[model samples]
Target: MNTSDEVRTFTVAPDDDGVRLDRWFKRHLPQIGFGTVSKWARTGQIRVDGKRAKPDDRLVAGQQLRVPPGGDAPHKKPREKPALSEAEISQAKDMVITETESAIVLNKPPGLATQGGTGTKTHVDGLLDAFAPGEDEPRPRLVHRLDKDTSGVLLIARTPGSAAHFSKRFSGRSAKKVYWALVVGVPEVHEGVIEAPLAKQPGSGGEKMHVDHEGGQPAKTKYRVVEKAGQKAAWLELEPMTGRTHQLRVHCAAMGNPIVGDGKYGGKDAFLTGSISRKMHLHARRLIIGSPEGGKLDVTAELPEHFAASMEQLGFDIGLSNAEPIRDDPPPKSREEKKQAARLHAKQYRKSRKGERRGRRDATTAKPKPKPKPKAKR
Candidate 1:
């Protein structure tokens, strides 16, 4: 209903600091589509502090955003979400393990995706409307994701600001997540690190991942064997040092000990015989991350029914293993950071060499001592 031809200017609020320019539009101007925003940005119609801005450009607090008018013009309505049924509402509430003012930790069950995709209908994101506080308030946001078939502790941010906060923790590698998995065989080394690069498989239409050493993104995982079922199976605790798509699954498969029931990577060898369920035996056991409200949020999810049954059948004692989070290895520096560090090191080296050269020059230029006049020919 904004009919004024004049442009509108908004001051970026503190809560929205560091958000992407397009995201700001989505948050503040829901009526405007991403295509429209991108077009406006391309045409230099949108300005941040009197400078043309890109959609992905990060906005700082107190910056003036100049938006051209006509964004509120009538357009095709967005598809409305179908109303949730009673059963769907119950299912969403049932998954909540812990709820704070800023986050909701869910013990997500296997087979439910974190977000929707082609052929994925009953995903966790669709149910998030159940958690919306009110008509005007923003719905909860997914800060992180789990595989459709890999379930465990999934965190949901209650607000956009908190979503950004949690996302930073995850991207910075400060968040600790522990996964429990049952692999086909005990690893030769009881505990070790798996460092492998991964890439999308060539012919799978990006539905699968493979270990691509020569040309792939760096990925690392630290694994410790909790207990073994006489070499037939082993319950392993896995910590991913890098967040790569299907990193853990690919790494474990590459280690020659594919996780039990993961047929995609391991194929026939991934399965176990005699009473083990075919369901993937990987569960996100625990998550520890900084909460928006100051302290840390540490929560553990109980093993899924199939996983628990398999462990019991294998006679593995859950109490025998420690669940403490391993200290995360520092994330690799970005290209810019690496360049900055190299420049600093070179500068220091040059400065030190300069000091040494100056000392040598001073010593060489100083007049030679008389050598105490040869001690008066003593």
Candidate 2:
């Protein structure tokens, strides 16, 4: 809606209230980027109640908003790429490990992205349309992501409803993801937790993360050393208690033993000498997630060729990779159950605070020592 020649005023709907001004525009006028909105606000072209507003200002229901004209143009949809070649289609199909009515599990390979981005033309998401060529079915959507260099079990939702169901499971922490990595050095502790918070590293162009205690999101990881090659390298199974970008990589680095071949975080120390492949030695080993129709989907992906070769070279027991599933059958909580849990947590917090205050009051009101009288006169 960017072709309008005249200014327009609109009232914020209840659904639109409390969202940032930029979000409001994105909802009603998808074509207008936040940059344009900010420019308009800065130049007094955009106003709320005749006053200039910031892009981040929260919108209120019933507020009068003045929008400059650019709303008449037809909305632009993403450009559709040419159809995948037969070879490319076959290649993508080969990656699929299994499929259900609602979901597809893929053993994604290294160096292949899950989704397309800047200069990323070939990815799993782009090739999904090849699965149902010449059909009217909707293209499958990616429910979650794995790093391009990290190969293994990636999930795709076949329908919008299924996507919503799976997204909720992941965001609510009901999905279980187990990763395996070969680290450059054995951890001092056989098994332990990493509870450091994480945030994006500044000026790294959003490609790197660092452990930041302050102003960072809480992140936790549980790791176990499965096998070791003396003090040089180790095979580790990692479970992320809280999902953050590159949480496993960052936590391993923080432990003074970065994942092997992760040059970004580990530098040259990430590599192993000799015949071992220097490709990133991380893999998404297993996933246990709730199914849309019923129970759980438990799947394990075999390691890629390079990873297996590296494990062999490091003298790591390949049998350790076949160990029993670490996490299984994660039951998803309903929205109502989550609400009840929040209420209970608040009640417990209030009760504990009251008890603490009572203990402090009793200590403060304790009787003072009896005064010593006339000792000086005696």
What lDDT score belongs to each candidate, Candidate 1 first? 0.88, 0.84
For residues 156-206, could you state the per-residue lDDT of candidate 1 as single tens digits? 998887898999999999999999999999886666689999999999999
Provide the lDDT at 102 for model 1: 86
lDDT of 2 by residue, 19-130 (tens): 7898788766667777889899998999998899999999897899999977333657633555789989998889988999888889999999988999998998888887
Off by over 4 Å in 1: 1-25, 32-71, 74-81, 327-378
lDDT of 2: 0.84
TM-score of each: 0.72, 0.66
Instruction: Estimate candidate 1's alpha-carbon lDDT, on a 0 to 1 scale.
Output: 0.88
The local lDDT score (0 to 100) that residue 173 gets in candidate 2 is: 86
